[model samples]
Target: MKRQHSMPFGAEAVHGGGVRFRLWAPGVATITLQLDGDQELPMTAADGGWFELTVASAQAGSRYLFRLPDGLLVPDPVSRFNPDDIHGASEVVAPTAFDWSDGDWRGRPWHEAVIYELHLGSFTASGDFAGAIERLDYLVELGVTAIEIMPVADFPGRCNWGYDGVLPFAPDAAYGRPEDFKRLIDAAHQRGLMVLLDVVYNHFGPEGNYLHAYAPDFFNPRHATPWGAAINFDGEGSRVVRDFFVHNVLYWLEEFHLDGLRLDAIHAICDDSTPDIIEELAAAFKSVPGRARHVHMVLENERNQARYLTRDDFGRLLHGTAQWNDDIHHAFHVLATGESDGYYVDYAADPARLLGRCLTEGFAYQGEASTFAHGERRGEASAHLPPAAFINFLQNHDQIGNRAFGERLCHLASPLAMEAVTAVLLLAPQPPLLFMGEEFAAAQPFLFFCDFGPELAQAVTEGRRREFSRFARFADPAVRESIPDPNAPATFETCALDWSAIERAPHRAVLELHRQLLLLRHQWIVPRLAGMDNGDPRLAMPSARTLAITWRLGDGSLLALLANLGDDPVDATPPPGQLLFATANLDATTLARGRLPAWSVRWHLQPGDSR
Candidate 1:
């Protein structure tokens, strides 16, 4: 008996037997397959930049490389399976094979999601996908509805922050094999939790990249990025370039059944092509059969443009569901920690700006001559937006790790300071994100890590030092020494979760504060505050800088979230409504005359029946 095979690259799953590997190199004369351990298999070219090789021996855990005629035995430029890069071999995974039990799970609506961001390589001692699965129950129990895993796209070697991934479709081998990742997603879904994988499309990593050789126009000469030439979105043969990424996006959703994606640094993706790649990709994602409803795109950009979050001129969203509200994080961080340098220069300790972020979707400084950038910064303000259209986070991978020293918010400020900040963030009318270990005041810093070739390694080190030199206070030798060495073993080792600390006293309290806060939000806030359309003005008393918002849900319940970023107390009179829950440390005795704590957050729910 003989076995029949389909097209090499786009083969469909039959009896789940073997994989037919393929590569496209029109410019080259010949191609060779570098199989596991020095075994080279010659390939036969068909036509139109395509080559095919079918071997029944190519099963799970097969190590293979592409041998170009130039004698370059590089790993598959688009390798779906990579085992040897970290420790083992790449395995072929079938998406249809996994039995998912999440048929009853309609993911939590965007407004109700509280995202927890984590880096797989530094999250645990083993630092892999499997390690993250072990803690999913804890997240669910803690009231986290979604896990926004940082970028796991393939980088050069074993460890990375994942913003510099080159292989867009392949998961980093260091994290675990692709199947292991599928299992992690399956396990998360079974628990009624959603998984959002971070992806990088702006640029490739500095090392282990070879796509340009096959197609130089894959990058644009018209525009350039700090990393390299921008992806060929507007260049010649850009349709294929766009197809490459569009396919990758669908691959994760359709192939791995990932719930959503967090795109890294979207502002850097300069595309001028008509029917822009962004919109085209959005349409393509919507075309997927069973997976269309579950996919979402989260962008990280300095621009708070409304069009990115809203529909196009014809009433269509441009492949984006949410964007990081940098202004909100900056305003709260500056007021809480009082460290103003680098990009923080534009941020002030103004309670008005903080209040504006709560009421309006953006800050007053939106494109208004930022002191930090020395240029006009701007954002769009419009009505066609839901509250969940913005993702608010006080501390993320960039906020804490990009500092001169890898110091978390806990190390930079007091626990009380963060507690007050958390109050507003959790109770606000937007999606809030908690960095890993932040819920418990985890003190470890998320230092930058990479496994690049020696040349790239030296470049990275020098570039990092040069970057810190921009801050005069951090330029001094002593100050430089104080900054944790990004490459040091201790930097990576210390970032792991201290499981025992969660069972201790002060740490337990911090963790409980987060858990209880989230529980209160889920049980009371979200159910009452979502989708309110009345012309209720955001409450801002003349005497206080903080702003209060009141909205009536469908269930005839009214909820109010107060945001305070000032030093003095806000003696707010709650519009003839009774207090349900207050954080001013005052009970019913002084509720009317007492003031909210300095830099505090308070949430009060007044039912229609209450006086």
Candidate 2:
């Protein structure tokens, strides 16, 4: 093993701006600036162990590299504009050059947001930022207020899931470069859409990750993650590591103008500090100058700890925003499809549980036994939160693609069942999220993809097969071959949205249902659902199989959602409100009578519409 120096990244980038440059070098003492190959500027060091350089007109397109004190060269640690490839020197980009037309765009609240998670490559046949731009109009019409893009940070090769990103500042060369991404965001904002970036701070990808070569202790040996050594959050020189990540957050917000960040897998972050790394990052973002609503943090944490969303403990939430609500997805999937295999064991086939989780408690597994994990987890109940505290989704990259084989909700159930699921997802109290191609029930699967070097790629391929073989019936290696070869171009190509699906019948029906649901939510729901009670909105679970939700609007117009999670249809009259929305077709007589179909969701407006 080779010894590497840790570069102090914080000392250089945080200097109150005159184009001060910073790069982390743990193993080296001296560093030089390689400005476009010829000009070498000496970098000074702060007493706290960091290298810094100040340059004029250090905006965008200024190509530069860092020469380690020992003679090795590397990219800038805080390169806001990586016009060069990740493995190459850094290129500067002026964050302020792009004309932003969204200064007046008021954000959609977390409670009201319908998030559509997408990948730039797989989102369209073009598989680039430009290609994704073509579909923004479709998303806007679909009723989504925010578009959560998968990681755009640069990685090795042309295709990846972005968790393995090594260059935090650069957009993948495969995604048509940096300005293309800006086009997408600017276009999104122009259409009244907020963009949430999916950020991976837990670990970097395997290939093209040279951070260790420059900063050895960037990862701590005391704690370990499944991928590799954990980041040094509380260890020696860990303050610099914290600053590195905090800088990344601010860079994305300040440079890309991204509205928010979805921090990937916070539970795996394993920092045992008093003011946890997450809290520190959150506090830093919250404290940034002129960041009112432009920057926010959303966590994808498996821990059912409400503190991830609550403001009660540690004030972590003063900076934190919301977490991905897996419990809601679990309960809804179990109830609708009756699939109780993996984590679904914690859930039962009950609409009431699903409704209750979203309406009142915000999670189905708060202080409950998890059969899949075979443990008693989630010991406390977090009921006193707002509806916006959770981000609900039927299919995310993990849920649909991480299964034994990538299988979507559309594949697991019938068309009607899909419609019912979509109804609940949209009409639920919390905000809803749609995975890429989900609006039309896309046939393509979002397989786990990576662009590691050959050995790592082989390891990932074999590992994916072996991992899924344990619980899955697909034991044959031939069957495992269907798991998309992540590095292959097809992996990215296959995931693109087949807009033609919208013209098909079942897909069109589902698409129409989504459109209608969005209309109903914006037109009738947002006005009624506001404020916090003891918990979130109270989900009225009526029985082992029925969920009832009533939203009393500000104008006294009650909106109620009723769903039958059972296999058998339940014939019951809805509460005395006119039937405004129903997953299944309800004749006027049936609407008046209120007979709900099996596994169906219905929305009813309270009587006295004028009120």
Candidate 3:
């Protein structure tokens, strides 16, 4: 089947022949279309500062750019592909060029999602889409239902975390062509894995964004983000700007056949209009015609806005499918690593209580003052939201890569502590996400890496080191100077996954543990998660570090968890049910006598009452 989303802007193939090229250059009076870097044609000016031209000879594979009135050349703002990086000419790609085989692929339900987040560059040796395709079977065997790829949007240089993407419509040439990306998605779908792309709608990259040169109204000076001026979602001329991003969402899902999107750091997207950009985007996705096709929308909002994850009376999603629950991660991190620095201070006081709340109520701080945020009120009550509305994880890209040394949980926590937490995370009702190499405890660190021009590279590297200066460990200037340079090739190389590590001793054992946990989750938990309610779980703190929680599952079964995450054994009564899984050396006699072992977790399932 041929899949393509017809968009208003950009170059589109005409019915009979030729390609129609259009550009929104409101900042400029006249715009010229430059094809193949030589053939220049003056485009007709239309209403609303639009320029249009039709070339009967121009077909697919045509490289083109726009020449401003003053002779400056810029690529198409909605470019489908930029072969020679961000500064080069845009390539006209026929969206229908790829023949899709997953026409019957309708996507998986949100409750069944076992997401594996990976960066294309660091995921494999080739650091390209084709390289990732080779590992599809491995992910399937790992029991992941979805693969969330870091942004592939065209950025300035060859190496990046993809958050710096400028071209929202084009896949980065560094990760292979647009066709190669389509192949990755197609291959993933063929293996029964839904592919979700991480999209950045908050701001453009630091360089190579030409929208300001041709359309200054694309940003609002009134609202400034950490990057720069916020997008013009509520200001004058925002209709076109909003449409540009709205079309981008459809473009990825429709043209590439993607199952969903994970919006990156949406807390930075500034918009004051009614039915804001986020709401409008959600409405657009919800309006998609196919009822059987499940297109999930995940968000990363630091504000912990529960309203975005709201559902209607019929349990139909009103906005986002889920949110990355940072509260749970912080609590779990503090509990395992016992590090009370930075944001960990919030959970350090009483991490066990916070964890118990997160297990039952979905969020730890519900309309509570945040000490980290200078006592500002944060988060809405999330207890009304289903557990599936929150995505839990022990480690993610930001958590690991943002650190100075990029240390994974395995690097900081004990093996027993890691194993205990892993069981809790995987077996829990909430869908769990695993970082690229977390399943096997790969030793390589996911360092912050980027490749920018010489001038910007120096600033970024210095800024990266300075960012950690606030921490006591990097207080000394000499210590801060030792931090890896983000622009260095060595920094990027160190982030790549060592696939061979899985064959080794400890790594093999970690991998096996993850595999077994996921297998049990699929067999014993997922089938009963369909109708699980939001406020169904009952939580209790049996001891300072011991938690006993019980949930009424969708299939009328009761799933229970009794965990002692501390270093010392705690007095606790095991919930009455059939024991499903437990930590190493756990005995029924010890549990019956009200003594739970250190760093131990037990899962039990009680059959529903047969009326």
Candidate 4:
């Protein structure tokens, strides 16, 4: 089947024989279309500062640019593909050209999602879409239901985390062409794996964004993000701006046949209008005619707004499908690593209690004041939300890559501690996410890497080191200077996963632990997740580091967890249920003795009521 998402802007191949090119250059009066560097066609000025031109000779693979009123030329803002990078000409892509074989793939349910987050550039040696496709069978064997790829939108230079993407519509040429991405998604669907793209709607990259030059109204100066002026979602000329991003969402999901999208750092998206941009986007996605397709909308909102994750009376999603639960990660990190720096301070004093809270309630800081935020209150009450509304993880891109050394949990925590947390994360009712190399405990660090122009490169590198200066470890100027330069080629190269490590000794053991935990989750937990009620579960802290939680599953069965995340054993009364899995070779006799081992986790399940 041929898949295509038709949008108002950008170049679209006409049926008769031609390509229609349109641009929204409200900041400029006149615009000229430059095709193949030789033919220059004057576009007709239409209402709302739009320029339109139709060329019968122009077809797919035609490279074109727009000449402003001045002598300057710029690539299409909504380009389908910029083969020569962001500063080059935009290539006309026939979206319907690629044939899809997964016509019956309606996507898996959210409850079944075991997301594996990976960066396309660092996921394999090829660092491209086709290379990622080769690893599909491995992911399936690892029991990952969805693969959440980092952003592939066109950005400046060769390598980036993709948050710097400027062209929301075009896949980065560094990761192969748009069709190659389609094949990757197609291949993943064939292997019964859902593909989710990480999209950045909050802000554009630091460079190569030409919107300000031709469409100044795209951003509002009234509000500013850490990057710069915020996107104009509520200001004058905001309608076009909102539509641009809304269409971009439909473009990826419809044209590429993606299963879902994870919006990046949505807290920075400043929208004050009624039924804000996020609401509108979710509504638009829900309105699409696909009852059988389980297309999810995930978010990374630091605000922890539970209202967006609300469901209908019948347990259908009212808006977003889920959110990345940072609270859970922070609590787990503090317990395992015991490093109370930065945001870890919030959970340091009583990490075990916070971890228990997160296991029962959706968030630990529900309507609570944040000491790290300087007394500013953070998060809404999330107890009413189901466990599926919160996606928990021990490590993710931001958690690992943001560190000065980019240390994974394996680098800091003991193997027993890591195994215990892994068991808790994977076997929990909430869907779990694994970073690229976490399953095998690959030694390579996921450093912060970028490739910008010389001028911006130096600034970015210096700024990156300066960010860690606030910490005591990097207090000395000499120590901070030793941090890897983000613009360095070695920095980017070192982040690539060493696939061979999975076959090695220590790495093989870690991989086995993850595989077994995921297997138990799929067999014993996922079946009881559907129709799970939303509310607080029974939670208790029997000791300083021992937590016991019992959740009533949808099947009316009671799933319980007894964890001791400490260096010493503690006295505890185990919850009543049959043991399903345990860490550190824990057994029923040891649990029946009312003594929980250090860094141990036990999962138990009681059969549902017959009535």
Q: How much is 566 displaced in model 3, in angstroms?
A: 0.8
Q: Model 1's lDDT to the true fold?
A: 0.70
Residue-wise lDDT of candidate 3 within 161-272, one digit each (tens)?
Answer: 9999999999999999999999999999999999999999999999899899989999999998898899999999999999999999988888898889999988999999
**lDDT digits (tens) for residues 1-611 of candidate 1:** 11111223532333456667777666677888776667688888887677777766666556777777887666665556566662233345444545665555445556667899999987777799999999999999999988999988787676778887776767887888777888898789888788898888888887767766655667887898887788989877686678777877778776677778887777788899777776677776677656425567787877666666775555345567778787777777777778777777776546455545544544344445666666766666633455667788888999887876667887877666777777777766677899999898876777876666777777776677777876888678667666665555566676777777788877898888888889888887777645543314355543545666765553556667665566676676554444445553545654655566565556777777332
RMSD of each: 3.7, 5.0, 1.2, 1.2
- Residue ranges of candidate 4 with Cα displaced over 4 Å: 587-589
Q: Residue 128's C-alpha lDDT in candidate 2?
A: 85
What TM-score against the true fold does each predicted structure earn? 0.90, 0.89, 0.99, 0.99
Better of 2 and 4 by TM-score: 4
Misplaced by over 4 Å in model 2 are 1-20, 38-46, 54-62, 68-72, 291-295, 311-317, 348-355, 532-543, 551-557, 607-611
- lDDT tens digits, residue span 73-136, model 2: 7776555445556768777654444666666654565556789998787788888889878888
- Cα RMSD for candidate 2? 5.0
lDDT for 289 in candidate 2 is 52
**lDDT values, one for every candidate:** 0.70, 0.72, 0.92, 0.91
Model 1 pairs whose backbones collide: 83-88, 83-89, 83-90, 84-88, 311-316, 312-316, 366-377, 366-378, 367-377, 367-378
- Over 380-463, each residue of candidate 4 has an lDDT whose tens digit, in order, gives 998888999999999999999999989998999989899999999999899999999999999999999999999999999999
- Off-target runs (Cα >4 Å) in candidate 1 are 1-18, 37-48, 86-99, 291-293, 311-318, 349-351, 362-367, 533-544, 552-557, 575-580, 607-611
Output the worst ten-in-a-row residue range by lDDT, candidate 4: 283-292
Backbone clashes in each candidate structure, one number apiece?
10, 21, 0, 0
